[model samples]
Target: INRLSSALIRTSTKCINALDALRSLKDGLDQHPSITKEEKERLLNFISVARQEYDEIAKKEIQKAFVYSYEESAKVLFDNYLDNIEAYCNSTKLKDPITDEEVSPDEKLMRSIEEQIGVSENAKKSFREEILLRLSSYARKGRKFDYTSHERLREAVEKKLFADLKDVVKITTSTKTPDAEQLKRINGVSAKLISEYDYCPVCANELLKYVGSLLNR
Candidate 1:
């Protein structure tokens, strides 16, 4: 699902990393706690068009590639990541494009962007209070909050993403006796790598075979 995502989406031919980052940000806009409600809604509403276009263009392939194995855990990690983005955006200061700063990760004031996901002012107030309370509790326990704040959550997300990737790209276990359908699928995935991703036939099949071996183990 790496470059396949790029090819399927509009990330190819353009800077794939940039567009992928936007898509990721776009996905997290809902849970970011720093942006005001309005800003969040605005970005989501605006980005929805691009997301729709990507989806339409890659409808079939995406449907094939994007099944989640551990959906809930992955979702929780994603939400926390989005929250980090929001926190960063709300800092009222932008980092120098050339230099690294404290945030690697906005409350717009938190309301503007939070609104995009239907966070009301009342809910925002309550959420802010709750988060502060949680932070204090964590401090009391000598725990720092960050992306890896929840070890179990991180492990779950990693497993989920990896499993989904294997499902998408791992060829059958025994190519020697692959059934007709599997042979067809293997051919399709190989053709995809060769024609779309510019992998040579030999290299693509070799990669697929390596993947198949891992899955077999």
Candidate 2:
């Protein structure tokens, strides 16, 4: 049961991290072509704050959910992508800071999907496939691969993941763990990120969006 719980938590964290990546991408798009110097500075400010908020959220989520071995392994990949994103966002700001009026929720989400997933056409498809892959791993058990039972288990798994995720954010202040060596290995290759970006950009982006939407539960 403890292992199961940890697996579920890791699954949830992956979903959240993926979603946040997409969200960051969307924010970049929505704020593109800063209209003025002031706008650019404002954009930078907003991004800094958003990045801080995102980092904080990720730390809490990961610490609480990744108590199991599988989760810890999975997070190495997630952290690598996040590290890249952090670099990307910072680079963008250094290039040209800008802020615009609020963007629509849908547009924001779309851009997020694009950035976290990828700007390339094939990269996006790979992202969706990765999500499915992780979902499969999370939902898998060592028993005889029972489809009916698997489906039911997935539903329950999702439910528990969300419940704990929400509780951690609401009831606790923060949760963070250090595993620098593990992170180094996971981020070193970006195996998971590459797997997700293996599909066509258009299809992959759509798939990520669809999967992220389901995470609302």
Candidate 3:
């Protein structure tokens, strides 16, 4: 949609420019002593209609561009959310065995799922790196920067990892409780990451510092 909108705008702009050139030619023609007033009036009216059409087209093009941008942003957000969910599931190590013929997902199939998840994670990492580079370039130019994009990227990465981990857990009729200490550590780590996003000048730097602190402890 964005591409289509851009094309429309480009085409409209060109048309408008051409119309302007035509009007200039008409004005030159009107200056001729031999030209009749009727001919001049006709040419001016045609130019007026053409200009009006160009303005309308320009407005429609702008609307289309805005719609395209909004849709694109929504899609990106959804993708990021799914990725985060997968990462969270993987981190939790919630998986079920398939050999018993009781689990929804079979062991072999689950392993394949994990492989796919890894591919997604690698892709997310690549995207995150690209965004970071872009953010850095913008920052150097003294432009405003937001961590929302990176936050979404990280969420997607973690969710994809979690989906694979979910396949590893054993399925049972009753819900099983996890170790409180492990859960606490996971929460703590996540909180630290969130803080880094909210407060740090450079997200990468903050992440490194947080990790270093964790290691030291």
Model 1 deviation from native, Cα RMSD in Å? 20.2
Off by over 4 Å in 3: 1-16, 72-217
RMSD of 3: 22.3
Candidate 2 lDDT over 90-116, as tens digits, reads: 343222124554322232322343443
1-217: candidate 1 lDDT, tens digit per residue: 4434544466333333334545666766655689898998888887777765544433223222222323454565546544654454354344434675643433442444344345576676554455555656788999875424544333333443544455543445346778887776677767776676565676556555544555566
Ranking by lDDT: 1, 3, 2
C-alpha local distance difference test of each model: 0.51, 0.38, 0.41
The candidate that wins on lDDT is 1
Most TM-score-accurate candidate? 1
In angstroms, how far off is 72's CA in candidate 3? 5.1
Let me know the TM-score candidate 1 reaches against the reference structure.
Answer: 0.27
Q: Select the stronger candidate by TM-score from 2 and 3.
A: 3
